[model samples]
Target: MHYEKEDWNFELVVAGAGVGGISAALAAARLFRRVLLIEAGPEVGGTGVFSSVSLICNFRDSRGRPITSGIHRELFPAAYTHYNEQRVPTYDELALKSTYQQLLEAEPTLTVWTGCTVESADVENGRIQRLHLQGQQAGTVAAEVFLDATADGNLSAMAGMQYEIGREGDGKLQSATATFRVSGFDLLKLENPDIQTWPAIHSLRLELLPYYQALKDEGKTANPRQSITCFPYPDGKALLFNSTSVLGVDPTRPDSVSRGMEEGTRQANELFGAICGHPAFRQARLDYIAPRLGVREGRRITGEYILTAEDCLNTRHFGDMIAACAYSLDIHSPDGGATRLESIPGDGYYHIPYRSLIPVGCSNLLLASRCISGTHEAHSSYRIMASVSAIGEAAGVAASLAVIQRKKDVREVRPAHIRYVLQLRGQFTEGEVERIPLPASPQQEPPVSVEPNFKSNHD
Candidate 1:
């Protein structure tokens, strides 16, 4: 175990370069905090880029008001324009990746370390005193605050924080998918060339369902999805397929993830062939498969407040709300087949309190992504990219606030201060957040109980 001591010192170190991590890094960097964003993969986009998740799930309240407006809106501007609930909301991953790259490059205070994984964590007194990362750039990372944005809660788990995996019943996670793209479609035969609209997309999926059904009947494919689910690219030239579900693929198990990839790629090709006979897809060609598997569920780090299904079902409001999520409780059955989706009852939205981001027993750690403290059902609701990005942005601001206040513990930081920054950046929040004397110190509030199929992440 020969490793030299080399520290990449910063005020904040965000692990994982997914949408959440990227958002957090940007938020912190913009706040003039010396920040570093480390990602295990070669690229910065994480699942949204490599896994090619096509759709940008709705991030609006019942009145069709955009609740998640900060970093998410910055990432996908089309989502914020001319709000229409009837339009099929989808996004181009390439465009998002380009935006991330440009934004990261623009942040002079931010340093991004791609192809790096956290190998060891030095924790003492419930704080990450030191972090050793291995990859092309192997070194130690030291920060006053660290954001765990691995989506799977890799950083929190590495720091020995308590967490839960998968559903409570059998502890099985949602299935993984290997999305793909197809271009050169015969658009003339479809209802319209502009397939981005809700009507066209809905009609197209129904029209192509019989072919997919025939394949299932003939045992030519293994995808459990009922119809041909896909979304149009922004250019309207290609389609991103979010189909092909592979059960029993846990991100923690390297072997499981490896096997899932093979099964998923096979399923993608099988589905492609099954639908090639259709008129729209006759000349369409498979562009490429996603580089990473889209694993919907991950470790839910135990935080001060564990958001439960009840919170989402009741559409509960919070006094310390830093961000809001309007998506439904969409749970993809671990066993496969049809997904179970339950809408967020009344207002069609709920506030995500600051306590949910603070890990239990961890003094300097915070959840910056899909791995935030929540129940399995609640996790399914907020795991979507839109909500995840908001969580990341909030965590980044909180981490910077902690550093600025010189607070020894993250829990000592105030929710109102975080909300103030988020509000300044145009993020959504509601209820009474005690406008604390910030630029000074703020108080902490204790509390809270708080995907996809071939099931979309509409929550």
Candidate 2:
């Protein structure tokens, strides 16, 4: 919907229309609450779309059961329906973006404002009273509960909430990347005829490595990555290169991000040119580079409970668990070193406690993105799209319950209540469930169906 310049009021206001923000808005709107989702970008879809990261990160546990469901499944139904470890699961960015638009538009009570940003927040005591917005809709928006899904904790920072950035030591964050798509490659020229499988894709990368290495040895590029890393599209015709590594790019700093984009794009082109020397890519075209650089780490908002690396390694369960993450702690080095990956033990997943979503000392604000409280090591695991979607869904439910129960503080809404709602919505949940009377909303719309096809020529 087109946003007009005017002051607005909502039961819930979500900042950032990325995956997390969209999930939060949809969850709340499905519950019959008035929701406003604000995005600074021209369209929905954050890193997963604009950055064009093709691979769908792990959301299933070791036993192959999905730990992250709910809105995530709705967005990427192919991932859930076509579960195959042999084939590398992926989605086209444009297809996912279309799904986001469909689900969002189906929610009658949900209003999405693209090209809008939450500039500031009005805090009274510990609660946020109003949000001053800029961009397409430049005015104040008051809400009973506010969710910070800006990925960089922009809204939480504006609300005077505490946050941590980067790793503990020198505060160096994960290296950023400028991803790009490439098509028109001859599959018959490749040793692996089936590039859709993990083994085949790995083989393809190895096959194209000599060219990339030659470029590096000749000092034709500034990228620090030693090897080529690319994922095949679901159709197996195209590939999304997530190989370039740009160091010292901080999301909170605009100047640093701008410089990073320039360097990363340069690296992307050099890499693309090098790969063209391969027999399979001789006729391949250099598809458009991702508009947004893929930033792995950002502001880790201080919450009621700070999740730690030990908690994840131990696979600890929380009584107030709201979500789960199955992805490994994959950290792209800040200094452009080798990537570090450590998988979760036992069930291959860990719980994301509800306390981690509630910003410290804030009564009505919730962290609904990767900005949620966690150590640097822990953040690397839950920062993936699937986990972030679950976090956003849980936060939305918690926020709505706070308004519905008429609780003065968000803390008053019990985790059991949130879990109950989540389980009813077909999301995976554990622990005790509190059966409570939920008020029916007349504004609630029926579920919207999404296309099963995952291919897109969106570029």
Report every candidate's CA lDDT.
Answer: 0.85, 0.90
| Residue runs of model 1 more than 4 Å from their true location after superposition | 1-5, 191-194, 433-459
Q: Estimate each model's TM-score.
A: 0.92, 0.95
For candidate 1, what is the lDDT? 0.85
State the lDDT of candidate 1 residue by residue for 116-161, as single tens digits. 8988789998889979989977878788999999999998999899
Q: Against the correct fold, how does model 1 do in TM-score?
A: 0.92
Which regions in candidate 2 have their CA more than 4 angstroms from the true location? Answer: 1-6, 443-459
List model 2 lDDT by residue over 1-459, tens digit each: 454656688999999988899999999988899899999999999888999999889999999999989999999888999999898999999999999999999999899989988889999899899999889789999999999999999999998889899999889999999999999999999998799999999999999999999999999998998889999988888899999999999999999999999999999999999999988789999878999999988999999999998999999999999999998999998887899999998999999999999999889999999999999999999999999999999999999888877777888888887988898898988787776666576544333321222222121
